[model samples]
Target: MIRYVHMYLVAILLVAGISMSFPSGRHSKAEAANDMSVHAKAAILVDAKSGKILFGQNMDESLPVASMSKLMTQYLILEKIQKGDLKWDDVYHADATDQDLSTRPGLGNVPLYQGQSYTVRDLYNAMTLVSANAASRALGRMAGKSDKHFVQMMNDKAKQLGLKHSSFVNTSGLNNQDLAPYQVKGTASDGENKMSARDLALLAYHFIHSFPNEMDIEKKELDQFPVTDSYSIPLRNKNQLLPNGKYPYKGAIGLKTGMNDAAGYGIVALAKRGQRELIAVIIDAKNKKGKRSSKARYMQAQKLLDYGFTHWDYQKISPEKFLPTNQQKIPVENGTKEKAAITSKTTVTELVPKNSHSIKAKLTLMPKFLTDQKKRELPSTYQPYGLIEVGASRVIPSNDRKLTELTLSFRKLLFFMLISVIPHF
Candidate 1:
C-alpha cells in the first residue's frame, strides 16, 4: 500500500511536468572557475528571463562593439514606437550625411540617396537585417534630432538601463575615424561605441524583455527595402548564426553581429531551447594569429551558449509545493469567492544548475491587489499580478550529536530504574 501511494504521487508529479533534480555535491569557486572556456578575449552568458549570469570570462572589460552598437539605435526606435512618439510608417528623408555614408565603399550600406524618403519600417529593417549604416544613422537623427544629441541619447539610455561599462559615440558602431566630419562634435576622433560583454548581455536582456516582438523580426532570413515602389533592395541577414544561416545552431533566434579592424569580431546572440532563453555576448574573438576572425565570433558564441544550456536549466516551482506559507491561493476581497485560486504564473522558472532539485523562493504579494475591498470583482487578465523572486543558497546540515547523546543517556537511566522496580518480567 505504501509503495502504491508513492507511485501515485510520482505519477501526479510527472503529469504536472514538475522538474525534479537532486543535488550533486558542491565544488569550490577556484575549482569551478576552470570548468568552461571560450575562444574570445571577453565573453558572458545570461539567463534572459531572470538576468542571471551563468558564465563569464573577462566579461567586464569594455571593448569596441563595431556594428553591434546599432543595438542601441534599434532599441531607441522601438521604444519610441512603443510610447506612441514614433510610428513604423513614419517617413524620414535621407540627409546629406546619411546619403554620403550609405555610398561609402567597404562599409555595409544600401545606397540610400539624398532626399530619398524611407519609412521607419524600411530603415529599421535594413539596419537590423543587413547592418546598413545609413538606415541606422537616419533613424538616429530622427530619434535624437541630430548626430550629437543622438549620441547623448544613446549614452543616457545606457545609464537608464543600468549598464556599468558602456559608451556610445555614434549611431553606427563605425570607428570615429570612419565617420570623418560626420562624427559627433567634441568627441575624440578615434572614439567608437564600446561596451563590456556583460553590459552588452544586460542591454540585450532588457531589450528582449521590453520589446519581445522585435525577436520575430530578427528571425527572418531575408527582407526587401523598397528604394522605389517598383525597385527594392534585397536585405540579407548578416547574422550567420541564425537557424537557416551558414553556421546555424538549433533554437537560434534574432540578434546582431558586428566586426571592425579595431573591435575585431563580436556578436550579441539569443537562443531559446524549451522554456529557457539565453543571451550571449562574445567580444573581440580572434584566431590564433591574434587577427580578427569572423567565423571565430559565431563559433565561440555557440560554445558559450552550449556551456550555458548544458550546465543549467529552467527549474520550475510546482504548484503542489509552491509557497509554503500561503498554499496555492490568495485572498480576494469583495469577490464571489473569499479566495481566488492562483497557480504558478506560467511555471515560475528559476535558473539553476542541471542537478538542482528545487529552488528556494520568496513570494511577495502586492498589498494593493489584496486590500481593494470595494471592487465587485477582480478584473481578469492574462498578465501576472505579482512576482515571485527566486533564489538559491547552500543548505547546511545540522549536527545533532549532542541531542542524540542526551536522549540515549536518559533512556538508559529509565531502563535501569524500571528493571530495579519490576525485577525480571
Candidate 2:
C-alpha cells in the first residue's frame, strides 16, 4: 500500500509538470479572445503580400519608433548589397560620430574602438540581431560620408516608398540637446523620429518581400563574430512568439523590435502560415515596466495571425470575368476613320475572402468626347480621347438594356451626322 501511494504521487507530479510545460487549451483560447486587451497606443495587422490591412487600431497616429528604425537601416544596407555597391566582407572604420553614438548608455553597443575595422556583415548582424548603435552608425558612415547625408537618403527613400508620416532625425535615435550638433534646426528639443504603425508594417512587408535571403539573418538563434577570439555573444530573437512553438501556426519568419523611453515598445512582426503571410506592428505599447509590452505584442500578433488564417483564403478571380462584354466604339470626327474601338486594357482579378461576391467597376472618360474644345475644326487623324479608370466595389450589376440601346442609337446618329456634315464641307 505504501509503494502504491508513492507511485500515485509520482504520477500526479509528472502530469502536473507536463501540464505546466505545455499551455492549457483553455488558456490559449482565453489569450486568443483577449488579444487586443493590452495597453497599446497603436497596432496593425497587414497582409504581407497584398499589403491589405487585416485589423488595426490607431494605426495612423505617428509615434516614436525607437530601434524599429533599424528596419530601414537594414533595408538600405541590403539594397546596397544587392546593387553591388557594397560587399558584406568590406571592412569599415568607425568615425568619431560612430564612437559617440555607440558609447551612449542604454543603447546597444558593438564595443567598437575608434578607427577599428569591422566587416559590413558584422555591422549588419550587430545592427539587426543585436540592435547595436555602433553598427548602425558604422553602416551609415559606410553608406554615406556623414549621418546627415545618410538620414537624408533615408527620408528620400521613405518619400519614394510612399511613407508619408515618417521622418528620421538621427541614425542612432539619440536624444539631442539644444547645444547638440544634431539637434533640430532652431529648436531645443531632439529632432523628431516618428513613424505610424501602417508605415512600419509597410516597411516590414517591403523588407521581407524584397529580401527573402536576408531574413535568415534574423532567425539566427546564435551568431558568432570574429571580432573577438575569446568573447562570444549568444544571439537570441527578441520576439518570443517564434520560440513559443505551441501556437498552431507556421511560416513565421523574422522582423525587428524597438523601444525607447520616449517611443515605448514598438514591434514589427512577420508571420506566415501556409500561403498567407502577415506583418504586424505595435507602437507605443504601454511598457508598465517593459516586460508586459512584448507579451502584449505577442498576444495581439497571435490573435491576428489566427484570425487571418481562420477567416481569409486566397482565390484567383479572373479579371476577364469582370470585364464588360461590349467594347465601346465612339465616332471620331474628321479623322482617317469614322470611329475608334476602345477596349479594356487588362483583366481585373481580386483576391477576396470566401462568401464575398459581386464586384462593380466604373469607367470615367476624360475630355468626354474626342472633339476639340471648339468642336468646330475636325482634326485630320483620329485622336484617342481621355483615359478610362476602372474602380471596383462590391455591388450588384444593374441592367442597362435601355441605356445600351439608347447609346447605340446615339452613336449611329452621330456617325451619320458626321458623315453628312463632311460631305457638306
lDDT of each: 0.67, 0.56
Q: Write the per-residue lDDT of candidate 1 for residues 287-337, one digit (tens) a residue.
A: 656667888898888987897788777555443343346534444333345
TM-scores of the candidates in the order shown? 0.73, 0.66
lDDT digits (tens) for residues 287-403 of candidate 2: 445454546565656666676676556654322232334524444444345444443222222233334344333232223222222333322222111111112222111221111
Model 2, global lDDT: 0.56
* Steric clash pairs (candidate 2): 251-272, 319-348
Give lDDT for model 1: 0.67
Error of 1 at 400 (Å): 34
Superposed by TM-score, candidate 2 places the C-alpha of residue 423 at a distance from the truth, in angstroms, of 53
Residue pairs in candidate 1 whose N, alpha carbon or C atoms collide under 3 angstroms: 21-357
Task: Rate residue 84 of model 1 by lDDT.
Answer: 94
